[model samples]
Target: MISLKNITKKYGDKTVFHNFNLDIEENEITVILGESGSGKTTLLNMIARLTDFSGEISGAGQVSMVFQRDRLVPHLTVRENILLINENADVKRMLESVGLSKAENLYPKELSAGMARRVAIIRAFSHPAPLLLMDEPLVNLDLSLKFSLLEKIKELQSTTGKTVIMVSHDVKEAAYFSGRIIVLKSGGEVILDKKRVSEKTLTETLLNGQSI
Candidate 1:
């Protein structure tokens, strides 16, 4: 489990998190919900040790992240992209799980936005880590593709059960995918944190969606 206690960060005088605390259990998908500039990404970065912060985050293991940007080399094929991250024996299986089997030889230039995003997802998952962090994993995709990617992500999580944390603006997506949801305000304060209801409960909320 990842335990964050009294976590706080500041850039000069501006504060990010103030006395924030959370206990992310093992093998659970924690989704963060908030508007733009709510420091959700900052929080994820902190957890990944990619950003400087003044706090105590207690966890000892490898961590990998699927960045907000696809971050793929435009000239590299899908297989090459995942290989670039880690040249382990698990690379082929990872790509297959994310549904990029047929596009194995296609370069980033040839894939659509959703397809590119899936490549990034497999890249992160390819890393040998106990914790996985993803930011807006399904950023620019049509609705049909988005849900398909979501299911693939779910399958990947189930296979390894690596502690997963993803940040997204869509509450419906969070509610549908995550086992627990943590809502954050623009001020970096956590507004709500609750376990997501089952699919039947989520269907009721998603179908009657209002403005986020």
Candidate 2:
């Protein structure tokens, strides 16, 4: 398990989280659900130690992250970019998993948005990290692609049994991928923490702004 004790994060005078705390279970998929600026991403950053905060975070292993943006290197091919993180990574298998086998030698600029996103995800998952953090990774894609990637994510987690913490505002996504859901209101307070429910129920709760 990963525990955060009295975490306080601020950007100058603007505080994102004030003495907040959370515990993330190992080998489970936890979704941080919230609107923009609700500090969901901030919390993930703190967990990944990508940002500085005043608190104690323990029991987290090395983390691999997929950002909201596809941050693939422009100069390198998909396989090369993935190899940059893990030389022992099975580039061919990862590419095939995402249906990008033909694009292995393609650079970031050569791939479409969805393909680039797949490459970014493959790169993150290929890295040998016990904890994986994703920040609204399905934001801009169409519904079909979104669900495809969602299934792929679930498959990866089931196969690897890695701890996954994903932050997203989509209720359907939270319901689909989360074993546990932490719903945050503004300023990083978790208004609801509950086990997963049916997609219809989850959608209603989110639509009505009701906390479980």
**Candidate with maximal TM-score:** 2
Off by over 4 Å in 1: 197-212
In order, candidate lDDTs are: 0.80, 0.89
Q: For model 1, name the residue pairs that clash.
A: none
Which residue pairs in model 2 clash with each other? none
Query: Which ten contiguous residues of candidate 2 have the minimum total lDDT?
Result: 201-210
Model 2 lDDT tens row, 71-177? 99899999899999999999999899999989989999999999999998889999899999999999899999999999999999889898999999998889887
Tell me the tens digit of each residue's lDDT in model 1 across 5-77: 8888887888878888988888878888777877889999999888887879988367988888989987887
True-vs-predicted CA distance for residue 2, candidate 2, Å: 0.6
